[model samples]
Target chain A: MTTTQDRQSAGVEITPLTAPAQRTANTAFRGLSITAASLILVTLAAVATFLLVEAWPAITDASGELADKVSWIRPDEGQSLIEIAGYLIFGTVLISAIALLIATPLSIGIALFISHYAPRKLASGLGYLIDLLAAIPSVVYGLWGAIVLIPVLQPFYQWLADYLGWIPLFAPADDGTVSNTGRVALSAGIVLAIMVIPIITAVTREVFLQTPKLHEEAALAMGATRWEMVRMAVFPFGRSGIIGATMLGLGRALGETMAVYMILSVGLTYSFQILNAANHNTIASYIAGQFPEANSQGVSALIALGLALFVITLLVNMLARWIVSRRSEFSGAN
Target chain B: MSKRIDVNNLNVYYGGFLAVEDVSLSIEAKSVTAFIGPSGCGKSTFLRTLNRMHEVIPGARVEGEVLMDGVNLYDPQVDPVAVRRHVGMVFQRPNPFPTMSIEENVLAGVKLNSKRMSKSDSQDLVESSLRGANLWEEVKDRLDKPGSSLSGGQQQRLCIARAIAIKPDVLLMDEPCSALDPISTLAIEDLIQELKSEYTIVIVTHNMQQAARVSEKTAFFNIAGTGKPGKLIEMDDTTTIFSAPAEKATEDYISGRFG
Candidate 1:
């Protein structure tokens, strides 16, 4: 028999092993992580493959300069990928800007009432009611714009031309009917704003509700009135979150296809007035309308337009995420 | 300046539920009065009522009068904003506004409420308030840093500075040291002692030792059980309550029995 002192000096290692239960749990977690990661990779690959195949014709050699593949200078009518790319880029930016103009203030007001001012028992109910607006299908919105929204806006566009026509943005035709003659950029913008309002308001209200209680309390303790406290505490704290929410709405507006397609009639001619809805064409609407009638080369051009819209929205959302991440530090009591 | 608060049979309610039942107490001018009790015992509720903050919570209602310097705080014509302007509160957690710089946080009260203050006067008030809270030296060089960047102890001091910058006659503190380290607690305790020379101070605290350390007078509160209203069991000189005779409940609470 070995003495305890002899065993201690023997330099043999005895491993106090991890329990089998823990080892099995670890193995399960490792397997899950690998599986989840591969799923994401596979989905990304599928999207990339789709975009590359669809966009190949636009980049094919048919132009004078390599760089001309991305330019709108040469509208070959049927085979110009570069020209289609430029139009989609312009449409995405124009739609996003117009939608943001209307959505920002509307969303902030809706969020304010839902998060801070509305009666306690009614706040959530009212919020849900508003969110129901977002759930209506996009096609329904397109139909509504064509029948109701366009007709209602017709008189306003005439009034805008009569009174505010001095301004370049309103200097379009006085007749604002929804016929092919009346479809314009303004109608597409209004449709996009209405479509995005619920998303932005719902997101912003949730963000504002998550503001730390103590910060509001501190503002109250300082004798700031409800509105004053909101102006100082709530607005400052919620600014970046609101910006992110608005950008998300902007992304939705950029990709909005049905409403803009149904409401706007692109006559292949560009003009200055935003109210010239009959002549306006957005990236999504242009692609949707032209794709079915398009030859193989035209289909490629439209797909390339779709790619440009995709890239624009992607860039905006990434910028929004960066802003939102910077804002997370403000959520704490500190 | 010295000012007194007379709380006359004050009752607080959240809708139909009674929170604090019939608390009547007088806070002497220019002294620190500690309201000592266990968790959810209405000490904070009672403190909030003094500043009209109970009304800030939806459906919260107060009955009876809180007369500060002879004016009833609950009078219909009286503005709650005006009442809060005169009576500033610091909460249990240190909450410095994240958007504001350290100096701006200190001056938030005056900047938001006051119609005007001379540029020099505003600067002087910020410096003096920070000095009063004993945080001036530590933060003077970094006044432009965000208030959230401060250490926990420094943030609490910054809140104290914010409360003082408004120049309120009454300063209400709800568990101001509960979240701080002992060293920070001692610092706040020292500041409270100094503050009582100029402002009427009412503090709600769970630490009996803290009550014993800082206050001239102590109000002991107890709640029998869940759903039971909290009651003020005893109010007396700190020395008498801790060392001498009082209600048995007060003694039990002080001696570390079930509170």
Candidate 2:
């Protein structure tokens, strides 16, 4: 009912606007975004359903003893699924933990060096090199681990068993002779460490770089040395970020298949001796090794093991999220 | 513990670009001196050079002598860390370590120096430093709370407590009240009056009224034009500078003619 003059007096603009087209685009893009998001959930659901369906036979079967068919340790012929995955799960956790232990400090150090210590040019160059390392195919790492790293680390493993043999982890077996085959959990862990370093370093370097400049200046103004400034300002600010990065590395290490399979002399024992050759077999490697020739029961068993690995990784990532969220109240970025 | 600062022919540069030209001033011990100027006039840059904190920035350098208690702070043999320990700084915006507790924030400087203190001593220091910043009564019951939980004014006071905890001879505050509200600014102005009895204080302020209110001596900085280095135009008692500055530019700036 209002005239143009009335509208103008009401402080409305008279310009011709393309708002309808913008609205149409907004609605279309929103629909596309929602479809993209739903696709992820749908895919996850499909994978979970498929894994459950494929693994159903191993969960229960013809004679009620099929659950024992996927025995991880001493899987002769007839074992239940619940009892089957114990050794594989243990090996996966042990190797990943060892790898994380070795990688965490080194990755954090590299990240700090790249973020704080290096010159701008050198830092960017190093960052690019690390990104390149991450882009290398896992198969290449497998080949390198098998060919170069294993042969090179044999002497160091022997030295550990020689000098630090008093420690229970490094002690030789009852016969007092070490397994000299370079293929051991320790070697696999070291390889995994090398593989995971790039990812952890990249993530942590970004976190350290994002440290608020005011906080660093505060520490430096307080008479803190360079190292002390990093310890006080950089580390505290990056704690949750470091935890996240380590968890990412841990997830990759746990799910790694080819490199671990090729590097570790797969064994079925439930031993914790990392230095002993032919003493470990992670679920991913076990699945990759056996899936090619597996029958229906074997395939179902492997699927069941894979499902267990999926659950483990899920739990670990959830824990990392919980830790990060719990500490978010104190983190500066929050 | 307050010490006199004598800056002689100071020139500050960042990557070969002169930020501040030859300027000299003496700041008396146990008194408050304020630097007032427009933004980008290098007042804050010059303040940082007092504690050797200017060099912390990459490519930032200074050619000058900042003598405190007859010792050249810029001496090659002198460690910047030690120099900073003797002269503490509070930044414009409140920057308490977000992860630290209120009590921990107070003890941050001392802890950085790796000084071993007994539990009771640390507790005493925390209380005394907070008291010195005029924040003890407000924070006494919640010393274990995270420093970030405090209000803006309280956070600034906590930062002041942190700077004073190390028992530094001089305290440098860079626009310490620019980000604060009027009430918080008044609180800080009161605290500065109390602090001047114990520690030499150098404050850089953009508010002329604030400079007149809190400072005994005032230094006015000015720049010739864009891309030119800043220079000190006048230094005198606050009343003299506010009422009857000698330089035409100083009078023009103080009387709101031009920057």
Candidate 3:
């Protein structure tokens, strides 16, 4: 009789929480997640819009003190609009080209060492070491390049001046000081190259390791040597991945500011000799160096340059993503 | 086809553990020899030893000698790389190189070794190899497509063609049909039968029926005890092994009573 009463009581009992309450709690959590994500998206859009709005005055005004104060806004001496566009556009391209030339081959070697040559136990630890290099503060890289890399490179500069100076790219001044001017675009490029190496190497190593074992075995079975197997199977299989890695590294190199500014002593002028630091400035460093002190008109011009960087990086990243997606179709499963 | 592989007193070790022990077998020229056993029986391990491919796994080593055409494969003077060149392999899964076109994959070994040949000669070789594997017509119009873009059966066939391109004396297959569908398995089985006429074929399979169907000679392997080395129970002509195996263990395994 007592057990029966207990069972009846249990069946008829009410809970402290209802289904609606649980539903409300879950809905609130989901709504909060969406709000947080939306906030980040809206914030970025607002910043871009603000930059555009602030730069409008500089874009409209021309041939005055206000225009002179804004570096990107100021037309070249007796220059048309077309020439101004060319100079701005070419500055970004030039920096990217110089950085890629120094970075691509070195990164490939690093990737090969990490993926194929390193001992299995050692590879993971070494890969993490490379990743740690990537995480170093950009300012720290700038300081190191300015204080250490510049002075150490001076002798090489003087030797090049003595031997290969007739080649304009390698030419040195009469003093042979090898200061920021000597370090110029070439020095900035080297520094930027070092900065992007970790990124490219880490990515390429992963891609190379993903090559199918059967493909490699097939090559080896065909009387191919180890190096031959890599040439026939690994290299061809990893081509798209390598290209994508190079583009990502190139993007980072192109937009780098603090290190380039620290290594390159330059005004707004562009020139043929990359070693002539006094002549060349990239869009990023130009904006970074001048924007802090600029008035409304000056601020607007700087924002325009930033906008150009945004558009360029966006297009490059999209193209890289597309290429990777296409490669995935073949690389899936077996 | 002109040479034979003789594995004498062979034992395979992965690290310190003995995976296969005292496996002695002779594979003749232009014939199909199949190693049949249950899972984890080291049939594949014994097969890899014949081609010196067991070394590919870190810490795995083989004791005794594998004599290929009267040359000791493990001799201090012999190069394993040269051994691999002569004895081609096909994996359980089809693995065509992802970035290479169909034609390029067929020419990969020659191109990498920089073996100079006229364009017509290369073209002829590619066509013949592809036809040999029964894949020429299916892929003829799509030679420029990536090798990985093919279906599983087609990819496996492409791999077979790649193996044949080097003109290897022996072809080693490890569960080659395990990853394929029924139709694909039949296609590969037919190819194997045809392949045995030109190249010596050694296969490791879990399917006793496949061993009976495809192999001229059959080897039965079984683990001795728990955590112990696998041993060859019996080996003989395919019909004899199935009909009247000398060892009780071989009869038990073949009858599906025990493994």
Task: Give the candidate number with the greatest lDDT.
Answer: 2
TM-score per candidate: 0.90, 0.95, 0.88
Off by over 4 Å in 1: A1-26, A60-81, A173-182, A267-272, A325-334, B114-121
For every model in order, what is the iRMS?
Answer: 2.1, 0.8, 2.8
**C-alpha lDDT values of all predictions:** 0.83, 0.91, 0.80
TM, chain A, every candidate = 0.82, 0.90, 0.77
lDDT of 3 by residue, A1-334 (tens): 5565686687965445544464777899999999999999999899778867775664555555555655545445664333443555566667677788888888888788878777887988988998998999888998898888877776677677678878877766556543443557777877888899899988899988987777777666666777777787788778888888999898898789888877777655555566555667777887788778877666766776777777777788898788777756555444
**On residues A199-314, what C-alpha lDDT tens digit does candidate 2 reach at each position?**
99999999999999999999999999999999889999999999999999999999999999888888866787788877788999999998887777779889989999999999
Q: What's the lDDT for residue A235 in model 1?
A: 86
**What TM-score would you give candidate 3 relative to the actual structure?**
0.88
Error of 1 at B111 (Å): 2.1
| Top candidate by DockQ | 2
Best by TM-score: 2
lDDT of 3 by residue, B151-190 (tens): 8999899988988887888999988888998899899999
List DockQ, one per candidate, in order. 0.61, 0.86, 0.51
Residue A69, candidate 1: alpha-carbon lDDT: 40
Please write out the lDDT profile of model 1 over residues B150-259, one tens digit for every residue. Answer: 88889999999999988999999999999999999999999999999999999999989999999999999989889999999889999999997479888888999875
